[model samples]
Target: MSTPIFPIQQPASIAAAAAILRDGELVAIPTETVYGIAAAPRLQASELLLHRFYDADSWPALPLLLAPEVPLAHLARSNQWAERLRNYFWPGPLTVLLPAIADFPFALPTPCVAKRVPDYAPLWPLLRALGGVLIVGRAAHTGYPPAITAQEVAEQLADDVALILDGGRALFGLPSTVVDCIVSPPRIVQRGIISAPEIMAALQRPAERN
Candidate 1:
């Protein structure tokens, strides 16, 4: 099947994209950091997409996004540092790893799960429409850099994906900065636009690398 790239400028495209996700299809969304393939929180499908498209074996612990109204405590065991970071950089490109609550809906590979709130404007409407967790992953092959354009995502994974919400290009061509806040003195698992020093300053302590 040909992957359809919808220009998000049209008001109807957001609803169309939401429908695709609701139907359990992968939709490429343009976030500030990079293009991410998003879907409803289904474990098997998410794992398959990650393996077939991104060549990733990571699951359950895979990066996810809480619905706009969902509280962090519903999925994660939050701490003071997490609260501070979320208040400052949420709805942005910062992914915080926290210990998953025992009853976290999805089956995670580990006890921890990473999540982010993308600050991208066009994506908000679709995310809100979904009204639940959105399982998201970078739209790129295993060894390649994050996909920034819908065309790049199409070319990178061929027709593996179902739809691409083309919002032109991403603001930040890099991926999100990941912080493992589940541990004491939260540490940097992966660095991107947000620097290590900056994260440490926000936490009010030095970060030990994970």
Candidate 2:
């Protein structure tokens, strides 16, 4: 069960990666922040595979990366602040936690669903082609630094993952800034690349919590 590394520059490779995801297999995909193990969130088999291979803590309330056009209304109970912040910093390393609409077609753990749209160019086409919830997280165990390159991902995950999209090292080499927009005055759950002050400034309001 050797994991295969695919060059994202190749259209065939991208297609193959998408096929693997459609088949409910896990793929290590590159993002601006770090390499993430990506899988189809709706598939039970995929969920099981993700839970079994990824760390337990990593599975709970994991963020699902979506394309820019994936309607945020269905996915989040957003407010003016949340919407403004999303407008300002989406398609980047910012994960927003919003109140989940009941019976939303994803396997999100809590009443809130964490979602984001990465700025990575290589993944856009595959995301457009897949057209479904793709759950992703840093491709490493708990307490380890996030994997940045395909080789790092392969080293950490080994044969557990089905494929790795080699898009070279991550630009930030850091994790995404997690924000709990579910609350009034969005709170910064975890700060990574984006700072709280920056987020507050972008929101054109004061951050009550950090």
lDDT of each: 0.77, 0.78
Provide the lDDT at 197 for model 2. 89
What TM-score, over all chains together, does every model reach? 0.88, 0.89
**Model 2, range 36-154, lDDT digits (tens) per residue?**
88887665744655565455454335567888778666556767767777777888988888887776775655566678888987788888877845778678867788799999988
Candidate 2: C-alpha lDDT: 0.78
Model 1 worst lDDT window (10 residues): 52-61
What would you estimate as the lDDT of candidate 1?
Answer: 0.77
Q: What is the C-alpha lDDT profile of model 1 across 178-208, one tens digit per residue?
A: 9888788788888888988888887874323
Best by TM-score: 2
- How far out, in Å, is residue 116 in model 2? 0.9
